[model samples]
Target: MKNFKSEIENPIISKDILDLENKIALYYEGKIDEARFRSLRLARGIYGQRQFGVQMIRIKLPYGKVSSEQLHRIAEVSDTYSRGRLHITTRQDIQIHHVSLEKTPELWAELEQDEITLREACGNTVRNVTASETAGIDIKEPFDVSPYAQAVFEFFLRNPICQEMGRKFKISFSGTDEDTALSFINDLGFIAKLNKGEKGFKILIGGGLGSQPRPANVMCEFISVDKIIPLIEAVLRVFDRYGERTKRSRARLKFLVQQIGLVAFVKLVKEEHKALSNQTYKIDTAKFDKEIILPEIKIPSVKIKNMETYNLWKETNVIPQKQQGLFAIGIKIHLGNFYTDKARLLAHLIKKYAANELRLSLRQNILIRHVKEELLPFFYVELKKLGFAETGYNSLVDITACPGTDTCNLGIASSTGITKELEKVLTNEYPHYKNNKDITIKISGCMNACGQHAMAHIGFQGMAIKSGNLVAPALQVLLGGGIIGNGKGRFSDKVIKIPSKRGPEALRYLLNDFETKKEDKETFLKYYDRKQEHYFYKLLKPLADTSNLQQKDFMDWGSNEQYINTVGIGECAGVVIDLVATLLFESEEKIEQAKASLQLNQFSDSAYYAYTSMVNTAKALLLTKEEKTNTQAIIITEFEKLFSDKIKLETPFSEFVYQIKKNKPSKEFTTKYVQDAAFFYKKVTTYRTKTRSNGNNQQA
Candidate 1:
């Protein structure tokens, strides 16, 4: 009911926010369908929470690099529109929850004041492009991958082909062979490399984690940096044309790679060369190559009250930067959460003492960059005052957990509650393992693996144990999973299922066993491999007894009420497309977008918009006859088979549509293609109208 003025310098972003406001109004007025509205809002990063009426807003932060001003702005917006809490995600994005849908536009507008965005942060588009938090300062990196990651993020933010895909796509860049960004579990993962003294990346394709986890195939041992963008574009084109649409589960790129061999997928990508916007889109790393700016003020003298604690913190949380006399400090945020009161202080501290930049890590922690060596004590003191100077950042004690039953729609059990309980267990009981980086502990509320539970050394997935019509909260303990660097990793194996309350004891059993039997200098994975999954299952099997469950066993952590698994509709997944009028309307909108792109002389973008328009129109016509239209390539082939003989056309429908793949996206070709698409839409609509006039008769 309230109107907010947008001060965003980018007119496109301003229009997007206003459009969201208009759409929200239309949906409330019963003009827009709920499904259509859901898709629109998701693209803008406004997601439906497990609790009805309140929405979750995911702020898109490319590679998790946030400026101090951006951090301040996010804190302000969170305090104003929603709760003061900020939740950092494993994807290297920040999410704020409990915001009103009607007020999202104003909230987004406020964030735009500091050059932040919400576009493509959710939905089936290119989600946040994550990278190693230690990208620029990592001593082992060949070159900084931040610039390349940022380039890809900007190139595909509003790309038409990915705007409405069958499923969400994820990409990541690991700065070095350590693979700290966890490249093995992304749709497209890039590992920074030096090939013959040239900037390049080791490319991995089609890897993903969900209900089914798949390892990415090695697409290339080395691809030049300049050509990576074009390669990604080509892969996206192939996916848009051939990826599954009808089945949500089988629609990810990983499933496509599984259905068709990686070799075939590579061949399809190569076939899209003619349609690609650029053969080599060179990135200007000069912009990202700037030196860290430090304040000229003198470092104030600070006294440490406890030398032992400070030493422990230094050994665990502090990291030496590649740059001389500089350090990077890791802030272990409990469950990746912090309030606005502390956020503002952090923003001020970094702006004045550090490099004016902070990177949110893939493990749901914050890494403060470019702090002078002498400022460690001062930074530590200041951070401790904010309740953020916790030791064991990114260690075994630094547990990663997703907002499961707390806010996520697909949460089956409680992740955050278990995470808190486990943290307490580690702190009070196993303090000696504070610096144990060999073991990773991750938890997810569901099998979707948002917490990256499947990739941890010790993983827990929320489940329910049944005993004759009664269900109790439970956890599936997993073992022997971790990143092995250089594009190699292992997905954890499910070891045993136990009651939720016994999770702490299960962890204690595993640790005690490892402590006693692990060989000297052997990692957790090696020790676990020696013992095997069955060994751990047998060890923890005693805790899996459900027949003797008590009343407290049915209660999940951090809740007073009894546990009940109520999973809502997940927005992270793809949406189903079925409405005919919506399809036709989208086609018209695509045509208009094509015209706008053409006017701007962006021939390649315009051509893709036109191609989508033609495909959408075909889908609309096919829906009228109740024919199957799943993928764009299929629609093109089926349209020719079903309508080339029935409708009079100057050229065959296949030839007309497939021209996109046969010709370069030059101005002349783009213009002709757009005109042809408009003509095809007109003819299809005319036939549909005539058929509808004849008592809704079905015609091919």
Candidate 2:
């Protein structure tokens, strides 16, 4: 492979890309283990697909902001490196699939030329930092959250503290109390607020969606803008230290908070204050507060082919911006899939007429901002040519679906196929719902909720139902899930299991009953509350009857052959290697990183790296004894209990490790900590070698 070091301008990013190149070489040479290499590539946003030998590259766009030039660059890279398709995720990132593994570094270098990054887009790092697409223009917002979200994204991108955690951490910033960003489902959620003319945020912590969904707890009703970053850092430090590690199923921050009550978790977070690099980080809002410059070109006159269709488009797709006459247009992408040809055209349209920038919404759609009112007709006409002028931008017809069996390894059924059918049902049979924003529909390939099905008003999860001797593709219908606003939301309840072919019929039944029985002007959730879960189960139970099955019932949507369950190993959490030798090798690597950080005068980062090295060293030794090490906290305690007398230390093992929290990350303290960590590693290595020589080696 060719070197990408010269192509990337930023030294840090260049090094990162070059490192990926070198690691790929090492893995091919059998020098690096598959699990270890998998983690490294995943952290760089290269994911394994359901198909063998191809990769999915997730581009991390902070808060979903993308300029026309960046969009064009992405399209060019996609066309060159993979298939000419761009998939917008629910987290506001774009993914390109079916790329060769060897070409990833070059692809990443190309993206960075336009200031786009893939670092921390996947794996056990802080994933993309997302925010409301209408953030800067929302009339109800106290202030724009784009700058703050950018600040957090920049601060933690390559930070040593969060490079590897037990599970992925997600954060979001809601522009208003409407919570369009869905704060209730993130690890750290911030809602912009103003108290007595002072800028701040309402913080929500420890929320997630999977097989189990948990609503976030209100950590603080109001915290100043400057304190939010520090607060997040403290929370991450606590989670890294005590969160579950061995069990991938229970590794999320929500589980940690659930295991040890909120009060105790909060106390642990507070204990991390001393080691934090900054007590408060004031974001430079002025950088993002630039005045909007409208285009100087004359408005083009376009004849409307249909006045009625134009009127409906304006009603559902056009949004009036907070600025006097400016507007934002919403493009409801079908299942968030669009081709490069249409992408280039949309990019050109936005650059010449509207704002040069656009936001990829959390709903897997696009929001074109700063569009002038006079250009509306021209945009509609131009977008119509590209098949981009679809109505119902965020209404009931705008369904969100993940790339299920299409590419995901864990997909049990086709989310996109069923989504296409359900969307047809809404458009052809229920046209009036094009303007209805009261109900939302989402579909996920599985229970992991990548499509955020658990939080939708009407949701479907892909599954397989076995009928005695045969298996068939099925959908788990869930209802009553929706955002209640103000950092509150509810997860849907499972009502019934029906064949994927019956999904459209199930929707018709639910909609028909809702239309007939709902009270005047009642929302979907209110109506659901009145009728209850059992009521909906009874309403849709007939569709669940599988005794009378057809030939098509055995086939999944979009598949020609009969259904066969072929779930692969999921790479969403990355692979974890448990080899004792690999752990020791990783410890040495961490020590080198600590030494490099110390030389660069990054004391806080050096200290954290050293702390991690010590933890890895201890965990490796404990594994030699076949000890049950599940978390950093448990590793610390168990190591001390088993080896305290054998190894001499200046202080107790707990005190030595806990010094990272107790002492400030000063030069003297950091230098001593790194030296202590090195000494501890040497001792453990010697002990392990002695044990192995004595024929006492145990498999990890």
Candidate 3:
């Protein structure tokens, strides 16, 4: 590996990149544990892929907003380091796969040149903050949520409190009651609102989609914009203090909220008020308040070869902006995959004619904003030149899928394969359905729902089916899931399971059935609800038969050979650290960070770091006893019961730890908290040393 240059303008970002470079060196030299190093690299957006020796780097674009220069830079970097391919995720992040781990720091440095970032893009931290792609242009929106979303993203980008949590946390901002950002399925979802012309948000907390889907509860009907930040800070403090640790499956904030009732959880969140960094944090929306600037270039005269196709494109791809005389064009990207060649061309197209900005949609497409209505014909022709003028953006034909068997290790079957076949079916056979936006079809390689299969009107989860001694790729068909908007939604019901080869047939059956049985002017969700889950189950039940299987059926899509289940460890969830020594080492690191924070006058951050250090230290000792430790709340209570009598203490462990809530995060309390954590660490280390010296005494 070559030495990395630190030419970054921001001192903080320069140090961060340098730290990553140093850690990479340490890990290669066998100084840092692989698990700890993985966590560090993941927080910096360097993720391991299914393929060995290469990485998938997720570039976090806050709210999916990307400028032409940044897009060009991303394309250039992809061509230089990656395979010239960019994969847009459902969360509105772009992922470039197959890059050398050693080159990630340099890649990040180049991205930062265009004000882009990969920090906190992946790992057990605050993931990308996504909002409606039409946020600023929505006709029904009371206010543009772009600034608020950007503020939240900026506030938590490198915040120490969320850097290393038990599991990943997600936040979203919906433009209006339509909830295009899908607030009902995030850790913290904010819907924009106005009361008497005062800007505020309706908050939803603890919703998520995974193997187990849970809808978020309404945390508050309306909170002023200034108080949103403080409320979010308080919730994060509570989660950091009490969320699950040992059990990775139950560690998400959603699970925590489910275990403890919402009322009690809110109580815990309120208790952290004194420790909040801000009681009321106001955001400056002036920068984003400006109207989008459109290029002054005259519209080019282009002769349409086919007026019918152009009209269709205008109807489906062109969207009216809230601003007069401007329109947004939606480019329906296939499977969210586009190459750098087309990407660079698109970048040039936007820069030359539009507002030089594009927002990637959650449905794996692109939205070109600020295009003059006169430029519609020119855009359609130019985009057609780049092969990006696909109609049916976000319609039934625009299928959403994850790179299942292609890149993700948790993938069980081929999501992209079935997606391609189904897309072909929709495009070639049912052209009339291109305008249908009511039905959404989503696919996941596995039950984890990275593609949001659980929330789709027609969903398919990858599975494996067995017939006697033979096994074949399968999909669990689900139906009736759709967003009802306004912070309310429902998960799809599992209908049936069919072989992956039959996935296309399954879709045809469902569509044909709905087309036949549905009453006039009836929506898909209403029809499904009326007919119930059993109707769909029985309709597609014949395809579920695994008795008659062919060799080709055994093979998954996009593969020439026979199918084999090669699911690897998923990095979406944080790595598990079972080593007591590693836990103790991390505790020491946290203590040092606390001291550094205190010196910097970040008292609230310092206090939280100290609190985390105490929990880590206690958990390390408890692990040695082979005791059950799941959550931070449990660790505090259990440590007191198990170790209070053994160790000489000035105060009870519960009272000592709970002092964080009782007192404000002033200099005095921050200093006291840090000192207490240090003292507790020393005592725990002493106890461990004595126990080992006493010949492994059980009670030591």
Q: Write the per-residue lDDT of candidate 1 for residues 1-700, one digit (tens) a residue.
A: 4444436778888788889999999999999998899899999999999887999999999999998899999999999998899999998999999999999999988888887889989888999999999999998899999999999999998988789888888999999999988788999999999977999999998888777888889999999999999998998888888888888888899999888899999999999898889988989999778877789988889999998999999999999989899999999999999999999999999999887999999999999999998999999999999998989998999999999999999998899999999989999999988999989999999999999899889999999888667788889998888898888889999888999999999999998999899999888999999999899989999999888888899899988887787888888954866798999899899999999999999998999999999988888877777887777788888888888876667889888888999999999999999999889888888888886877645442
**What is candidate 1's TM-score against the reference?**
0.98
Model 1, which residues run further than 4 Å from truth? 1-6, 696-700
Candidate 3 pairs with clashing backbones: none
Error of 3 at 84 (Å): 0.3
Deviation from native of the Cα of residue 101 in model 2, angstroms = 0.3
Ranking by lDDT: 2, 3, 1
Model 2 agreement with the true structure over 146-262: per-residue lDDT tens digits:
999999999999998898899999999999999999999999999999999999999998999999899999998999999999999999999898999999999999999999989
Write the candidate numbers in order of decreasing TM-score: 2, 1, 3
When 2 and 3 are scored with lDDT, the better candidate is: 2
lDDT of each: 0.90, 0.94, 0.91
lDDT of 1 at 121: 92
Model 2 vs. true fold: TM: 0.99
User: What's each prediction's TM-score?
Assistant: 0.98, 0.99, 0.97
Please give the distance, in angstroms, between residue 145's alpha carbon in candidate 1 and its true position after superposition. Answer: 0.6
